[model samples]
Target: MKRNKRKSDEMFNLDDIKVYMQMSAKDKLYWLERVAKFLHKITPSKNKKIWERLKERGF
Candidate 1:
């Protein structure tokens, strides 16, 4: 059975891509950090090197 996806999962359509492309540098940085943090959280404990890299980048 497929799980229901969140709105974030559906945010990569053309309109959203346009909006992302039009975002200011600061806005882009903000979103980038958010994505990095999210990835860091879900990363496996076995990947300590990956986690450290994210931390070094201030994620």
Candidate 2:
């Protein structure tokens, strides 16, 4: 039998958040900021810094 899930404005767990961060750093940072916004946490404004760092690593 299949179970039904409830729909609520709940936040993802830390593990899920980590998974998001494991995405390409640029994408990771973008999602990180979005999740933070949902949880009212502080996150950097731009992903430029992350992109620059990745570029420095020759990504």
Candidate 3:
């Protein structure tokens, strides 16, 4: 048996959006916060000005 893995750049389909839309408000907020934190952790802090701006914006 063989498996076909998805490419990293593949876009989410309507079904995926529909599933997300069906989630409760609380669940949606949880996921949003999780993604934000993950992005913050991965972002490089090469520019002090940008980091200060993000902090000022409450990111």
TM-score of each: 0.57, 0.32, 0.59
RMSD of 3: 6.0
Candidate 2: clashing pairs of residues: none
Residues 7-56, candidate 2: write the lDDT tens digits. 47645455555565568878867866887677554435466577679999
Ranking by lDDT: 1, 3, 2
Per-residue lDDT of 1-59 in model 3, one digit per residue for the tens? 12345468866555567778989999899989998898888888776579899999999
Report backbone clashes per prediction: 0, 0, 0
lDDT of each: 0.77, 0.63, 0.77
Candidate 3 deviant stretches above 4 angstroms: 1-10, 51-59
In what order do the candidates fall by TM-score, top score first? 3, 1, 2
**lDDT agreement of model 3 with the native:** 0.77
In candidate 3, position 1 carries an lDDT of: 13
- Each model's RMSD to truth, in Å? 8.2, 11.4, 6.0
Clashes of 1: 0
lDDT of 1 at 38: 96
lDDT of 2: 0.63
Candidate number that wins on TM-score, 1 or 3: 3
Number of the predicted model whose TM-score against the real structure is largest: 3
In Å, residue 19's CA in model 1 sits off its true spot by 0.5
